[model samples]
Target: MKRELKVTSDGSKTLYMENWDECYHSVHGALNESMHVFIKNGLNEVEADSLHILEFGFGTGLNALLTLSERGGRSIQYTALEKYPLSEEEWNAVAYGRTSEERVAFASIHLADWNAPVEIESGFVLKKVETGFEEVEFEPNSVDLIYYDAFAPSAQPELWTTELFTKCFQTLKPGGFLVTYCAKGQVKRNMKEVGFEVMALPGPPMKREMTKATKPSNV
Candidate 1:
């Protein structure tokens, strides 16, 4: 593996080896993008007291930490997939500057064994899967929410292809939502081709748009 781990321009987040460039949280603002996609669009619609969440790229564990901190009384079964996982030192360096509560939660996730189910808190269960995006497997129609945080299409084109969206389509239950910071025309079109109802929405600062795609009930 290449030594690609380094602090980003934001100085608070670390960039990992997956050719992904960004912090776990926005150095500009931590809660901004996360709230828009994950909380508002992803978790808010789930009716079940417990929900199954799948994150395509568990970079920085920022989204997971934030979700656990804000959502109370609901059980969350989170399965995160990553090809090149971050090391403990890398996670700790970036996580320590977060809220004390979030810092604690983030530590728990980083320490848990990969590919094995681990309980992060009373209502949250986390499982980290270390595998290539193409090889990571999940049951069809099983995931309630998906955090599509892969690198930009320019950097990692394979992750943004139609075949990848097709896999995501198969993994979602009816009404499940897949949220991402990307709203490129090709990305949206590819998602639509895979049977998802794609929505273009306002993105974080410096970005013009984002995307949220839902699996149809009929599919």
Candidate 2:
């Protein structure tokens, strides 16, 4: 079952279950936070003409949409993992508002087929993997960036554990960045245990801090 959630003062659409809330995009402004973390901090530093990106929770396809819009000079192979994905109708109801340029970009993401990789535009290929995070398999040292935007630790503790971080660390190339809105101490410790150098940074409004973990070249 799918239900709309009220996030933030702007009343952006968030998805929720009995206790779990996913995707802060709607409440936080999708494009705004994505650009800040992924584009500014992660993707901009990737010098490769082609890059592979992995996102843990592909809610509303907001990160995918924003990334496609900003991919000017490089080709991106984007893979997103979602277990209980939103239906097409549910996805449509989420308003992207009058942001014509971004709205147009966002529309293309939902129209893409699941599992089968689709080229939404030149230099941007998106593939939706309808599997849980634990079941999904990624090639070691292949991913350039990881958007670890799962629910909070209280809601989904498994996603924040050392085992999960170990899997994520194995998937990333040396120097790749893992960016998430979570700043919990346990999450940081898990990342460190998995060989990531964690950094705490300022978060969006109403949030105190966020975390960015980087895999070292030697690891």
On TM-score, the leading prediction is 2
Model 2, stretches more than 4 Å misplaced? 5-7, 10-12, 21-31
lDDT of 2 by residue, 38-105 (tens): 67766776788899999999987877876776778689999999988887777777655347977776
Q: Per-residue alpha-carbon lDDT of model 1 for 1-219, expressed as tens digits?
A: 443445443445545444355334444444567667777777776777888999988877878887787677899999999887877767766654356777777888888999999999998999999987889767998998899988778778899999999999999999888999888899999999989999998887666788999999877
- Of candidate 2, the 10-residue stretch with the lowest lDDT total is 18-27
Query: What lDDT, from 0 to 1, does candidate 1 have?
Result: 0.79
Question: Which regions in candidate 1 have their CA more than 4 angstroms from the true location?
Answer: 1-12, 16-31, 96-98
Candidate 1, run of 10 with poorest lDDT: 2-11
Name every residue pair that clashes in candidate 2. none
Q: After superposition, how far is residue 19 of candidate 1 from its true place, in Å?
A: 5.4
Per-model TM values vs. the true structure: 0.89, 0.90
